[model samples]
Target: MSKLRLVHCLLFFTAICILLPPIAARGGHSDYIHPGDGNSSFHGIARHLFAQEEPRPSLELTRGYMTNDDLEKAMKDFTKRCSKISRLYSIGKSVNGFPLWVIEISDRPGEIEAEPAFKYIGNVHGDEPVGRELLLRLANWICDNYKKDPLAQMIVENVHLHILPSLNPDGFSVRKRNNANNVDLNRDFPDQFFPMNEDLALRQPETRAIMTWLRNTRFTASATLHGGALVANFPWDGTEDRRKYYYGCPDDETFRFLARIYSKSHRNMSLSQEFKEGITNGASWYPIYGGMQDWNYIHGGCFELTLEISDNKWPRAAELPTIWDYNRKSMLNLVASLVKTGVHGRIFSLDQGKPLPGLVVVQGINYTVKAHQAYVDYHRLLAPGQKYEVTASSPGYKPRTTSIYLGDNAVTADFILIPEASSRGKLLRSNCDCSCKNCGQPLLAQFFPETNNGITLTLVVVVVFLCFLLQRRVRYNLWKQKQSSRRSITV
Candidate 1:
């Protein structure tokens, strides 16, 4: 080869290396959809999309949007910084090699082994990304401000928060709606529908990881986050048939209470209202089979909820400030409510009044009307010989609730919570003032003296602006270097 030709090739290769650094840094040809208009500012596009017409009180707590990479870093940073408060672990790995990370935040380390723990997961779907951001914010907020904030202190001190910030990491990496295998992890559970050609049961690693965690952890109350809807979807989601829509199948009253807590948290976004106006009610809405919520309820015997965060397909980054405003308080309320109640029971029936094994009973006592769901594991703690105000329900029988004292930590409480002969009970209007319409009453109002320690929303705005400045500076430096290299090559 001629020396001139060699020189030309070397120069071309150098130019390529200099100009393509951004592409290289972005993880190699991944289709990460940034929220932007005209391909300029993804953040601006996100902001405009989630922009609320009427300002809400709670929408001001978000500081900024974290990219997938940033989120990973934040998780690492949090665990490292607050090692005293949290323990980070990889539940599994995504198809893209990102760890499915879970940060177990607690005041007491041994509590998880001793007592039943509650779990909260965010960003199961890649599109609904706010929960991932929010959970991080919540974790950070609690760690930073717990000493000053009573609510934060109470939560960390009491309940052990097992948070999975990003469940569908493969989906998150590519910004796809489903996992890398094109399977919706939510619908990939081992249920009655399993072995059917359509079901992706135990197929995806993500599903397997979550299922394994549930089997191992013994979670009391759990929730998964999604978007493109504005309601908290509870169990029996597979069916819309009213005939099969009674509160509880095996445990009527307990299901009702669970449903009530979910409803309360979201200010009572009614199933009827959701069906009338929400996305899932539409004929065009994607129908999922063998989802996580149903499997959790039936197989795991865990009370779980699917919290649909936003109505937008991809909520705008710019609107995150506003979105967090509405969500932060509601999230806090939901977590706080879970630890408030003491005695929770679910009434059920047995064949010839015999004790049925593996029955779930939830008893809610000192019920205060609140708009958030409280966390309780009525199933695992129930013993053979303990006294419980039980509401027993089983499939193909009349639902029943009764008071019984058991013997020697035994399993199974059999009582018939009378099922309505017809599904004609007057729909009671929720008297709750809390966010969720179905929550009975605010437990905080009863116990902790209410204080006007409003969240420092202003701090969030300042932090967000600082993040914006930092990002802009980084982009500017990259752009400047690219321009300089282009000029040099031209000369």
Candidate 2:
């Protein structure tokens, strides 16, 4: 509270900010335990633990294409036309104030279903506009074909597919790789290995919007569309040591399988000579920091892939239809893949027979997926033909594990957790808090003795730091006063 202390505190904060940039440049952002390490029942996300843009292909010839404004209108139109099957919503606005619109396609639009949810994000790189065009085509195609096409029907009935055609419309409008502020939207997420972009203010509006959207929604599986390459990229986006190498996450096998599904479904992606199988580990392709793909996997409990759908960043607008055709099956298959593979189930309370929105973990996999709060439904994707030990756990409830051989078709595993009433008593008597709560003391006081200790220690640290700041300020002021006195005497 002293003037001297305040000055010192101000200096300390300024120093912290000044020292952060270079380190952020090296790592850039924000546990991934996908695999490679040993042992199961949830491996560590990361072993070390610590962790294009196309040019003026031109807006002049953009007649047949949907402008950002057109895209918004088209989205609204689709929701209206497919009123029974679809609805429109916005995540947030872009830096240039473009509403980031999303069209949700499902049997029951805007309603919560125990069904698995999948999202397709496109046009992350503004100049690689192929994704945005293709995604709109995809949304329309499903709407028109869902009646007759079994694949389309399957997707509409089984999955809630949310399509965000353009994440960086400002970047797209300018025909650049980044958003309006020139920040690469794809590279603005918090990376796990290097904690760069961890500060919310430093991240761009588009990035913040995506983060906020993830916090509100639970996506079982999702994919973002990118152009300029013809391969599917999976995590770990960067290695632990920041080296360029083939690094894999805990569910490396599962991710590879997912990638393969897209590549093979595409007309010619599977024939790529650059990346065998048309799939490359993200780091193997290129090392990047603060990528959206890795962050989705790490924090959102969402299985995400970075799909490079086109080799040409900006092919002629005429190629849009062909590109959509090429990617149509892949897109539909990828969404349907959610219902066709992995483990699908719900959790419930044994006593009340009520749903519990608990978390599901595969024994060997490092990631955890949470069930929908309303439906208590969860969908987990793993490589088919693998045997996995799946475990479901909820707070204050007994955890349960089950083993199953997951085949090509989806397998259902429901859990009923028993409530554990004596956990609090066990916690107080545990080694972490050895002494029993004194009967003579207030119940609240005895129960939270460790919390009280923590507060006391925190106060002590704050006081000491304040004193140090005050001393430094006092010394600095004295030095200034001495210099003034010396000048006056000399005069």
Candidate 3:
């Protein structure tokens, strides 16, 4: 063959190799094998390489031990064994068409509200796969040991555990960080009115399914499992001037109560510490525009927690056992804590006489109030029924408290905030500053006629007309070029 032709052929082969899947394109590496291949040496080596670095020895051993198939099969096997205790269903499909399975484990079956439901979602991001495996293991362990383990029996009997083992299956399949459309599922929520990129907002099927499921189910408390920095991020991300993030809502007492429960259970975890010197503002963590936890709190009315499970990226299979050891108790503790405090309520608008769309209704204390009884602080921005609050409030409104009692099951409360006439009048008066002695002009002089509406309409018309004219010009140029080419061809 000619040297030039040979070079071209070689380049073509290289391009083909680059385009192929990694498992197929790479010629040399260990062959993909099943976890149960019975080769102890291989399993040991794999475990060692992916071992977790946490001080908890038990969890580090089992951290990176299972694959996607292992988890799926385990879920199926678990359902078969515990048919009486749990039922599995497809909540939604992932972007890659994988089923987003939700395994409902309960003591009795009927409307979920008949019993308390605790939601545990794992692997929202594909890179953090351990939660999926751990959840399966937990399910299996609970079923298998329920007869013997009193704690397991107590949990199964009292709480209905809803386990979403994989939230972003498309991301999990390729081991990518984000979903198939490269959107972070955690940040793709509709909590605010701002427009989202059409491609991204509706891009990931997994996220869509999750949102639908959450809308239908009324959960008391929920946790989303992720892997990266290990910390339990709480509500009301720090303020601009504050050194550390404070739970800003009136229900800060409740926020602290929940945080304290989580911290007490996972005392060894970094999130156990109180607001201190090194902590970052809760809201400013990564500056995410819309997040699942925030939406859950503001819109879903659930006390949601973002649980960062591990520090290792793609932890080794062997590390699975270790991860479970440390987290299993913590996860169980959250469920127990929710059962202990059945706190629940809805937020409403003070002026509109309807549910507020987006607000922070927290169960905390107002700094100005005497520190005696626990009272939830209300931020003016909370969405109705999206957060757990014993009390609710809005701007220019009197705060309302509910007598709803929290327990092992669900509780509901509606807030009716009374608008403050004085506050409303002050807001309506636009030129109250005109009363300043230095300003000689009357308040009415500072006010302009309502010409803004006409100007806005005119601007819209002009822009539309310009766009139409540009489209016509471009089409005419294309037509003229085509006509000229046809004449030349005839010549």
Candidate 4:
């Protein structure tokens, strides 16, 4: 081999190494979406051919927006910086294999506690990237101010806040409204009145991830962010006849209350002329079937709201700061609402004072909230300044009802249920009252008016029996805990 030829070969290999890295990086980070990958249906082609094309701004509008990879890094960085109060995890992956990262913020991050859990999911529609940006801001704001700010501190100490910045990273990468498969995720959940999205096999991976997440984590309430409008929308997102009118769920008043919390806190959302008080019922605004908001309520036992934060979709990147400012308070207050104004408590059986994973029902609201299996704690969100008859019951136990006048602050009303065996009610009546007036107190101080000896004997026997039952119950629960592997749903 000639010396000159050897030098030329060395130069060629060096050039290949230098150029390949940049080419690979560009391919990995590019936001470009192939038209073929986006749509292949005849309907899609026909619509494109006949429909007039609307003017779309160049990618310049997304100049300051974080790419999918950048967003993933931001979440990781946040968790590291705020490791004391935050944990980073993923619900699932997008069609393009982008991790759906979630940032969980709490005083005790990743550890189960008797606290209400709330989630904020943004960027359901890829084009509506404002939510994703604002959600990141929300997490950062909470991290920065949790130590000094009362609202942030309360949320961190009392509630488990999960923030998923972008649910549709694939669509966002392409600046489209749908996912990579060209399906609208907001309309991809199971519907109450329709069976179109009832097939699990046909469900998108993004939708399935959300469904599985909810099943695993007991979210008390949640809200998704969007763009193209400015109003807080709450469920019955659809109707049986597909008509557009005021269609409400059984918890209409509660939903309205929850929606108002966001709209009223926004800088100018409440001043909107279109939606009254900057809030609208989903069906009343315009019926949409298989909406995530409705499915969250119906299937997941979570009250969810669809919030349209901006009038312009894909606004200039420079406007993100101002938009975040407008929504900062609304976001903080909505999370704080979980701990500030609600009915939260645990249920226990009188026999052994064991936590009973029972059902909590509020009178006049045709919905039942179940207590956490581990802690038996339930968080029921209700509008403040109202009287509610809360009833807690479990199988084989006598239900107890208590009236609470929920004021501006939250109320904790625990229940001690009695077994429904014959003569058990009469025997336990003196010690089985709920957290109402004179709870669990002896109605008869003296079993016999004349004999103090009889009352003393009765008390001694009851205490002995209760002590035995309590010991047995504790041992049984410990054995079950050792044998069974149960998923922990943070209260």
Q: Evaluate all candidate structures by whole-model CA lDDT and list the values in order.
A: 0.51, 0.75, 0.53, 0.78
Candidate 1 lDDT tens digits, 1-491? 69999999999999964653121000011111121122334323322322211221122232345767788899999988988888888888877778888888777643442223667788776645777877887788778987798777656765667888888777665565567766556545653332221323426788778878876666666777666556655545443321223232343334444444444554434443534322121111222344677678666656676666666635557876666666666566556544443333223221121122223344653221111112212333232324566454444445444565543322322232222333542222212222222233221122223343323333432444344334433633532332221111000
Candidate 4: stretches off by over 4 Å:
1-57, 423-454, 461-491
lDDT (Cα, tens digit) per residue for candidate 4, span 244-327: 789999988888998899999999999998889999887777666657999999889999988889988778889999999999
Backbone clash numbers for all candidates listed:
59, 19, 48, 1
* TM-score for each candidate, following the candidate numbering: 0.55, 0.75, 0.56, 0.79
Q: Is candidate 2 or candidate 4 better by TM-score?
A: 4
Clashes in predicted model 4: 1
**What does candidate 2's lDDT look like per residue over 164-203, in tens digits?**
9999899788777667766667667877876655667667
| Candidate 2: segments with Cα more than 4 A from true spot | 1-55, 59-63, 421-491
Ranked candidates, highest TM-score first? 4, 2, 3, 1
Report each candidate's C-alpha RMSD, comma-separated, in the order given.
Answer: 25.1, 22.7, 23.0, 13.9
TM-score for candidate 3: 0.56
Error of 3 at 347 (Å): 17
